[model samples]
Target: MLCRNCLRATRAAASRPAIPLLRAGISSVTRSATYTTSTQASVRHTLQTRLPALPTFRTYSTSSSESAAPPPEKPDYLNEAESTIWDRLVAEFEPTELVVQDISGGCGSMYGIEICSPKFAGKRMLAQQRMVNTCLGDLMTNWHGAQLKTRAP
Candidate 1:
């Protein structure tokens, strides 16, 4: 009984708020930025292409061959405490490279030890570190903390 134009007029009822239709052509949005000296409302990262490239199948390196530089000689310039820890690690692991530093300034309370040894060659990283900690014995207790890095030769 109803005409086509009459049916279309009843569809948009009065209770609902009308949603404006979005037309095309906006290519970018303008953002309000604040000074670095003042508090910022939000921080956004806009650089997309500068990120590390997607990895190839089963390959991680960006280069053809990774020829690493040889490590430095066992440093003789270490203070007495650093040398003692270095000596113990050298004897136990027979490390190809070792660097020990007193990271707690002049206090000798904390150490940073990086050791690369053939003993670590076949082991997982966590196991190699556990081995180093075990070998350090009571030396582990005397320090407030240590930044220990162990790797296979």
Candidate 2:
């Protein structure tokens, strides 16, 4: 025997109006309404109304207005004291390759250093780093942070 609830639901559905669907010169098929959920509509509205306009970026121009002056013969970041850090490393380790960068916007507060030296050959990574820190000595007090890379040549 058919369920009474199912029979009632079928009768109610038959009495309801049928929805129209988009047709490509063919028989129609039912489709859902176009309205979006509240969350989706809100996200779309925020993206359209609340977001700021995109910024315009310009490329470096070598025109006469822009000074082509040979980059000041040295980096503008390192002051005399900062430069001395690399100089001292060179004096003590005689590194094969050395690169030292003042990464604190020229304030001489932080450094990133890379050095390859025979002096570090037998040492563990921590020991090598300690050696460098020990060499910095008093200068370490003024530095905010340091990223050091050391290798045996």
lDDT of each: 0.67, 0.69
Error of 1 at 96 (Å): 0.7
Error of 2 at 73 (Å): 13
Stretches off by above 4 angstroms in model 2 are 1-78
Q: How many clashing residue pairs appear in each of the predictions shown?
A: 0, 0
lDDT of 2 by residue, 11-113 (tens): 5545666554333332343323332345334434554574567799999767744542221123466668767987788777767777888888888889898
After superposition on all CA atoms, what RMSD does each candidate show versus the true structure?
A: 16.2, 17.6
Clashing residue pairs, candidate 2?
Answer: none
Q: Kindly list the per-residue Cα lDDT of model 1 for residues 51-76, writing each as its tens digit.
A: 45677788556542344434346687
Q: What TM-score does each of the candidates earn?
A: 0.52, 0.48
**Most TM-score-accurate candidate:** 1
